[model samples]
Target: MRRVIGLVLLLLSVSLSAQALSWAYAFVVLDGRVYEVMDVAVLDDDLGEVVGEVKTMADDMDGSYYGDASNMYPIGTTYRKVNGEAIEDVLAVEDESGWKRAEYRHDAPFSMRDHLDKVAYGFVGLGLVVFVMYRFRRTR
Candidate 1:
C-alpha cells in the first residue's frame, strides 16, 4: 500500500510540473523593456526586414496580438514583433509577409535563475533529515 501511494504521488507531482512548464511565458526585451510573449517570429537581418507573417489575423480585443513580420529570436539584439502600442504593431502591414511557418517557442525553463540549484539543495536537505531520523530510530 505504501509503495502504491508513493508511486501515485510521484506521477501526480510529475504531471503538475509539466502543467507549470506548459504555462510558462517567453519574455522578449524590446528597447530595454521586457514583454510576455504569446507568439514569436523569424525576421531578416538589419533594418528589421519581415521574413514572415500571420496569414490570418488574430482576434485581439483588449490589445493588438498579431504582427506582420518575423525574427530569429530574442537575445544579443534581434528583431521581433511584440504586442504593444507601436506604429509597427499592426496585424497586417502594407508590404505583407506571410507566416513562414508556425512560430513555436523553445525556451529554457528556469534557466535564467538558480532554480535547479535550489531544488538540488532541497533534495539534499530532505535526504539528510530522513537519514538522521532513521539513524536515531535504529539507535533507540
Candidate 2:
C-alpha cells in the first residue's frame, strides 16, 4: 500500500510538471521576417512551391513562458508559401504542386496591453457597485 501511494504521488507530480510546460504559441519565418501564427495546416494540394527553409529554431528560454519562437519549424527544413500573399497577415505555403504545403494563420499574441482598458473598466465598475452597496447599508 505504501509503495502504491508513492507511485501515485510520483505520477501526480510528473503530470503536474508537464502541464506547466505547455507550448503557448508557434511562429514561422519567411523572407527574413518572423510571423506569429496559429492553426497551421498542411494540405494535400499542389498549389505552392518552396519559398524558404527554416534557418533557426527559437529557444524555449528566448521567450518568456513559452512566448518565444521555441515552437517553430525545424531548422534547415524548407517551407513554401502561396505567391502574392506573403505580405498579408495570413501565410500559406506549398511544398510542391498537388497539395497545400503549409498554411499559417497569423495573429498577435494575447497581451494585457491590448485589453488593459477593458480590464480597468471592469475593476472600476466592480468598485462602484461595492461602494453603492456600502452606502446603502450605512444609510439603513
Candidate 3:
C-alpha cells in the first residue's frame, strides 16, 4: 500500500512537469515598436506552393481573430487562414511576387493561464506540506 501511494504521487509529479506547451501569439518586436507582420510573399521557392491563398491578403487582416485575411502563423513567418478564429491549417498566397505558405499561433485564452496558475500553486503547497510532515515524522 505504501509503494502504491508513492507511485501515484510520483506519477502525478511527472505529469505536471511534462504538461503540453500551450500556444501564444508572440509578436515579433522590431524598431522599438510592434510592427505588424506584413504579408510574407512567396518567391519562386518551393515554400510558395505549400502556402495557398492565405498569404496574399495578410495586410488586410483586422486582428488575430478577425478579418477575411489570414493571421500570421508561428510555424512559418507567413499567413495562414484558420477557419473561424481558431487556427486550423496552413495556406498559400499569390501576387505579383509569387507564392508562399503560412501558419500562425495565437495567444492562448485566459482560462488556460488561470488553470495553470491554480495547478502550479496547488502542487507547490501540497509538496511543502508533505515535506514538512515527512521531516517531522523522520525526527520522531
Candidate 4:
C-alpha cells in the first residue's frame, strides 16, 4: 500500500514537472524587442539568408513562464527567412527570397509543444491506473 502511494506520488510529480515545462514560452529578441514566438515552426526548405542570430537569452522561471528559445533556435544560429511583415502581434514572414507573385507554401513540421497537454494527461492517467491496480490486487 505504501509503495503504491509512493509510486503514484512520483508519477504525479513527474506529470506536474512536465506541465510546468509545457507552459514555458519560447522568446526571441528581434530588432531590439522581445517577442514570444507563439508558434515555433520549422521551414521545409532553406530559402532565405542569415539575417540575425540570437544574441542573448533570458529564462524567467519565476511565474510568467517565459523562457529562452535555445532549444529550438539556439544562440548564434542563423536561418533563411524573408522580411517579416508584422500582423498584429505576430510576425508573419516567408522563408525565401522570391518574387512577390511566386508561389510558396510554408508548412511547419511536427512539434511536441502541440501535444504537450495530451502527454501530461497520459502521465496522470498512468498514475491513476497504477494506483487502481494496486488496490484491486490487494482486495483480491
Point to the candidate with the largest TM-score: 2
- Candidate 4 off by > 4 Å: 1-24, 38-42, 61-73, 83-140
TM-scores vs. true structure, each candidate: 0.22, 0.38, 0.24, 0.31
- As for candidate 1, its clashing pairs are 41-71, 42-70, 42-71, 43-70, 43-71, 53-98, 53-99
lDDT per residue (tens digit) for residues 31-65 in model 4 = 43344444344444533444445543443342221
- Computed on alpha carbons, the lDDT of every model, listed in order, comes to 0.37, 0.52, 0.41, 0.44
Tens-digit per-residue lDDT, 21-131, candidate 3: 332332322111122333665344334222222211222222322122323433234433323322233344333455433343343223343356579999999999999
- Winner by lDDT: 2
lDDT of 1 by residue, 1-140 (tens): 99999999999998776421222343332221223334433333212343233222222232122222122232232333323324123221212242111223332222312355568889999999999999999999
Ranking, TM-score, top scorer first: 2, 4, 3, 1
| Model 1 accuracy (lDDT, Cα) | 0.37
**lDDT by residue (tens digit), candidate 2, 34-77:** 55554545453522566565554554643431121224555655
RMSD of 4: 19.4
Higher-lDDT candidate of 2 and 3:
2
List clash counts for every candidate, in order: 7, 10, 14, 1
